[model samples]
Target chain A: MTVQDIGFGTASAQPLPAQKGPVTAARQRRTWTIYAAMCVAGLLPTLLGASASLQAAGIGLWLPGAGFLSVGGWAAVLFPLTLALFVFSLVAWFWAGMVLGPVIVWLGSAALAGAMAGDTVWAGGPYAAAFATAGIGYAFHRRNVRLRDAALAKIAPRVAFLDASLAEVRAQAAEIPDPATREMTPTDLAALRYLLDRALQPVTEWGGFDIIDQFQPAALRYQLNHMGFALGIAQTAYVPNFHGYMGQAQRNLIDKYLLRKVWGYWVYESCWGHLNFTNWDPAARDNIMLTGWFGMHVGQYMLASGDRRYLEPGSLTFRLNAKTAYVHDFNTIIGSVKTNYDSAEFGLFACEPNWIYPICNHYGLASLAVQDAVTGSDNVRRYAPGWFKMLNQEFTDEAGSIIGLRSQHTGMPIPFPTGEVAYAAFQNCFAPGSAQQQWAIARREIAPAIHPDANGKMRISLPGKGLDTGNYKSGHTGSFASILVAAKEFGDAYVAEAAQNSLDSDCGLEIRDGVRRYTGGSNDTNTYAILGQLMQAGDFRRSFTQGPHAPSRTGPVLEAASYPAVLVAQAISDGDNLRLVLYPGAGEGTQTLGLERLQPGRAYTVTGATTDAVTASPDGRAGLDVMLCGRTAVTVTPA
Target chain B: MACCAFAVYLLSQLLWPLRWLRDRLLVAPAVTASASVAWSPASVAAPVARKWRWKPALLLLLAAEVFGLGVAATAASVSAPAQPSVEFLDALHGSICSAVKGSLS
Candidate 1:
């Protein structure tokens, strides 16, 4: 929905008095006049200048720099128009408290600015300010918009616990009067069941889709738009009977009939959340937050797409992918060498959730794998050759499993990494000085949670809250020094397992007396984990958390049918199992467990720094099992 | 100045006739003409008018370009170790403009 759509939600029948006030009439004229003037003056000039320089220099459309396309032609065309749109978006800031609208306008401005300069050699550095501006502005605006968008704000809260019980859930569905629906296949049905597994996971329960986060809510803000778009798109892709709704017939139906009176309430915020922690006015952006969120949001949807829609063919996306260059978790080292963005070079550090921080390499590449799955996009493909090359360089070891860096938060990088036997490792948590951290650190090495313990569960917690205001983190790009393996463990089960093991932070969220508490240690990471536990935990875990406009939720496991409802539609098209296995004190053959499940006959696994392969093996493992010096994966044959 | 350098290169990419678009039976006559018009060299050239202004414009552009060049150089130099071919090609790209300009003018 457009920015103006928010004002129409209340269904207030307030007719405008025809020219009752001259002042009002004059104000309208000025708004349009100035907007027009800017188009002719400010916008026209910027476009011409860019077009001229690019053409004259022979930079062409395929600029060698990063952000080349996103910032180029579109910038020249839409930026000026958007500046006008930004002013209009602020109406929400006035009415929606401070959460939502202004951020959209702020983001519009920054995105436009990025478009303007992304093609240049020194683009992202200077352009970083625009990103920062968008992040902070959007965050502030998010609060404002949330306030004004009452219908969206007032969605009836759902009972999440109702989702947990498998039998109860099925019985509830059976109780539904409608008997006309056809039963789906076991595969499709099973997929639906998977989504229900952790229906109560934080990201999902909150409606953010990312499912876990304190700052985000499922309401009409983030979910209504971005996540909503994803869900809606996914629904269309999966439903055989669903005719095209994007074009005329469907749009006409919605516009003429359905939406004529549909309340703007229960809408999504914006798909793109803003996080920037940079020098461009802290009030404007938080470069760390944005870079982190950007990596997460992009990875979540981009990696999920089963189609090429995620890619901009013949575009910058196809040239310099964010997946490979930015390096979300263990990205500092790779990005340090490959691109200009890094905590080492630029002071960009912020709090990102999950394990694999400081430098969680497996999660880093697994995250990139997510982007590739979305479209197998040309851009995704371009970076894959290089990304896998670099990822194995530092992250992988002699065996097939991963080897991750343990952030020296409490102290220094020990030569013998904590829990060296494993392929991937993450600090118990980044807060070495925390009251609880001493206990975690003193435990000696971090161990991969291979088997469910007495509790039959795993847990991880959010690291120390707030931005880094000190020397160590900002200097070393180590603020992520904690763990934010946001997109680790892409397709390989082994990799996924290893990556998941790193996120052994606090996971319990038991709410009491309307107060939600973050109980220590629930090592659940990834959509699969949250979805999985909620499915299995059932009523036992109820009263844990609530959903948007709902009572404290219990037993609300998402059905596998809901996979399309989460993440981007494109991601579902190209399916690749992703993982990152961290071997627990590996000696000879400890590293290759997770990757064995990969369909060897159909899949070709490569390993080592140059994506090398295993020529032969002493153990007489299948030739594919003999993963080269380092990493490997088996997959369903690539389409 | 850059416009002069890129004109030939850009034209080269578009050297082939855009016949499929115009000759296609399915395309409505109305849009086809405009589509071609949108890509015409004259239309593309018109944007240059607003850019070619006074000394300040040049200076601002020069500064931005220099900064861009510096960034390009650093990245280019860093990658030079693994791919000498790239380094050599970059050197070649740098000289192409000057070399071409000398002959064309």
Candidate 2:
């Protein structure tokens, strides 16, 4: 009381309650106690008021309506039910407005009322608002969908091109250190590059497949020839154009050759017609002659692309008895030939169901060789000696040429051309020694038909019977092309030059953009021509004896920004050293060449037209700018 | 029915219009034929036969007939006639009497 009497303010009056511990715990407790008391005092009245209201508003004031329907029994039932339905309808209308946007539901309501009740005046106002809302929403939705679709459409082509290029890069990177494409000589490069360039030209007329079962073998042959060409082109290069053409070849192999639907008519239709042209109509699951070519194409693709994706089980499904049967592996397709090899005929294959064709059997044998190369199988080596014995014993005619066609059932040679020179090179891919022997025999026997033209270029008169030409033909450019290819394989330079010269003269040679092609020839003939040009003894021997051609470990990368359009014969990299043989196809002026897959932090010296020692950039890249023209070889070596 | 169809086929061979009708109607076209079912100039000119074997379809029809006859017999046995036997007989008698009276007059 003495301090309070002297205090001027509340602080001085309260001034100083004695300090409790470090914290005023008692003071905090007292303050909270006070707050609790005040809160209870204020909230108790509100809670009591709410409780009183709950009691007072018990189901709200009773509406001024009857507790039960105040009418007779039927009226009592119907009247309240009607009233309930009315209330429900109103609730549903309000619910619809909440759910479906106020304006959209109004349109629905207006449409229904106008149509059902003929309430035209009530419909107009709501209908207008609803339509406006719907139109705006639809426009927005359409625009969003279009924008999304357009984005996808714009990205698709670029992605596809990039994907193909990346696959090609991966394929190149996967190659082992074996017979590299760059190991080929200058002659080899010229021939293979030229043939590949020709082979990549779009096959305009594939001859329709619809006529295949009509005994029209030309259409089927056309597709097979292209298949062979596509496989051949895949061996040396993975250029985008050549790689893209493989799709067509794959389609022909699967859809046309392996597809039973295309060949199914032989089962029921021919039985009705009582017509049998060949054994091709029968649905034999393990027919070697008909199916072996497909195996060859697939094996070659495996060897070329270094992609074993197709070798997985069930990658190919075939129909037997109009039901699908899984083709498990490349071995399975190749084994079709191995399993069905005519043990009785000594490894001969049937051309049709019951008829054996020595030439077609050669393809089957070649297919086996391809299988051996791709899978490390010893089929060709295992069967070759036995096959030669059987072939010589049963299939060869008196002239030391294979009999063209023989009936497997009768064991009698059908009166066919027996043998021809055009097929000798084909056998070289599988049995080179036997093929060389065969070609020698054919050359000696057919020497009488070989005549020197006025220009001294040797031309052979083709016996039109076997090669599917009309009559005994003269000036057979296709035969010349075939002979040229065989001659090259056998290393008969004299014969090859003559044949090449004759073909150039007779078939109307066309060379533009460094691509050589015969302008006036059927697709089959042109394909043979390309094959003839590309065939080299080294490539053939390596492929037949060894496994597939191993691409280089690293290669010169074209700087895409300032890349010149050039025909690259071979781009090879060996231990960070790049060697390139390229000829300008459409490109001119100076071009920049970059080295890819080089060792990082290594310096490289580029030699050819210019020599410069340069260190690889952080991304393992080193490049030189140079001027190039026809057929220049560039080498880059690490310093 | 198959026997009748075969008999009809035999008759059709002798009559030109019936033969045409038989090919057009009785014989079904070949299914899954690579070539057309109808004769072409090339096929007609060639030695290869282009005839359809219609006997299989006829045999199928015969099997259907046997099954149909069995079903008809089973259905007939399971239910009585719509009218009672006595009523049926009375109706038959009245119809006979009317026919006889008309003939006599």
Candidate 3:
């Protein structure tokens, strides 16, 4: 069978094939069912009217103080307040994947009910038990922290001595590949298919996205941003001049980001976390999580495609409602990052209220770098030194690893999984020296984990049962994907290959209808895996710092082509001539191809098509009909 | 017993608005107040009055409370129990008492 017959040539217009196994969905359904059962069990005592204290305790299990609904007095008002608290706790749990939220709500409400009913046995007993459990949990957590710190201390000196030069890294990244001949491998095409399947769908439709949680990393917003990042890299490295489907995919992600379901959580976060109830504008204040990542996404699109549409005033407007909209474009979004950076004492602003994460700040800094590249501004030079200074001083641990998180209000550090590996690729955009140093340390640490799999293929086997933060499940897809990204950025082929292998063999790699995704991972990790696959050496840094190759700007481009029928694997131009490597996406047949940006009124020789020659229209456009059998190659040059 | 239960229920409803006023008037000032000895009664009272305009808010709070209590009383009278469900009322009373106790503790 031909490669096209094995689902490699599926069209972008068709809906993504149904997922083979909805594991996360099944798990979620089971969890919700258990929670519902618990609530139902809690209802029995209340319905029986066994005793006031018993009923109160029961109500606490369902919705705290719901018994007040039966009190038949002004006290009934308290029921709504308690119910609101319960709902807020659920939101918090989903928002951050913090199990403690629901636990606290359940136990605290139960204790409160008992106290209100003057039943020491029910309320006081559970409250004390909760405290004891917490105390034990805290003790175990501290012990783990101590062990982790001691281990890091041993590696501190080695990391400190690792040599990395910013100039060398920059010089290496400055070498751009030729735009005349660029093609994607079959693996790259499969990964691209995964992105297209989601991006080609309606912006409102969320068919392929992970909806396991709405928290920072696991949220749908993150999936959209990461998908955009992957597509941006693809556009820069492979098809620099082709802006057909890839451009649409990137724009759809940006447009989907403007949805309220994606970003409205910031409103609640603003009210309770920041104590600011007057305005709920997401981009107005200190949500670098949204503003920073989104800036890079939108800026990279403009830089790569030379599509300045998003740069238009109010072009990237986020409408909260019919009347209230935070109207912003590329400039204003980057402006928010600058404003926050200038004022922030920590040099890195907060993501969720009171929590400042250096990993997120890496995105914030990279966004500035991309903005500088796009607008010819000196944002990185102006702000990065101070930013790095604060980061080193306040946010670095004894081992020189960037601390995962710190409280913006209090100076307390919180342990998170954002180690050097997670920060390396993003940090490489602006601070290559520090990024390389991080990768060096991370490589040394991760080396021991890379061993031959059952089939003797090198694969990463991370220690312990790693957590996929996207779904709050026990999996290492995210960890493996992260290492793959870092390895690709630092030009460590061995580690990158091993990480990819691990994702392929262990992470349930599924390719259906030409789209490849690691089904074991969430939408976020799968996107990262795709990004790692798309990058060649310095692609990440170059996409942010220098953008697409210069010839891609004023070159002949393959503009119009039907999907599934004509899969343009490689479309590049060196100013005058257009070269395209096409595959029969649907089957072997004759297909029409539209070309644009040619020299007006120039006669061009076109090979591997039905017609041998064609003349450019006055508008610098031409059409060619090509016989697409297996791997059809087409080239149009001035005769 | 019924009268006492009714009184406790009324007091429980009052607690929420009282807590709101305490947060705005009492807790906010203490949190924001400077440790200077040159504090004046008029200076403090003027800002408090100007910033919150508590008079209208208090009036609104009281209005809502009255309206809620009327609705609650009407609902209770209409759904009056044959056996005089004083056990539920007593439980609610105990809840208010326990809340007060817990706060004080």
Interface root-mean-square deviation for each candidate? 26.7, 24.9, 24.1
Write candidate 3's Cα lDDT for A232-292 as tens digits.
Answer: 9888888877777778889999999998889887877777666677788878788889999
Candidate 1 positional error at A370, Å:
3.4
Candidates in descending lDDT order: 3, 2, 1
C-alpha RMSD for every candidate: 28.3, 36.7, 18.6
Q: Place model 1 in a CAPRI quality band.
A: incorrect
Compute DockQ for each candidate against the true complex. Answer: 0.01, 0.01, 0.01
The ten-residue window of minimal lDDT in model 3 chain A covers A3-12
lDDT of 2 by residue, A115-210 (tens): 221111221322332344356559967975674454335333332333343243234223333344434343444333333332333333222121
> Interface RMSD (Å) of model 3?
24.1
Tell me each candidate's TM-score. 0.22, 0.50, 0.70
What lDDT is reached at residue A159 by model 3? 29
Report the lDDT of model 3 for residue A207.
62
Candidate 1 overall lDDT versus native: 0.25
Q: List the pairs of residues colliding in candidate 2.
A: A554-A573
User: Candidate 2 has what TM-score?
Assistant: 0.50
- Tens digits of lDDT, candidate 1, A45-87: 2345564323212221111121222344322333334434444
* Model 3 residue A611 CA deviation in Å: 1.9
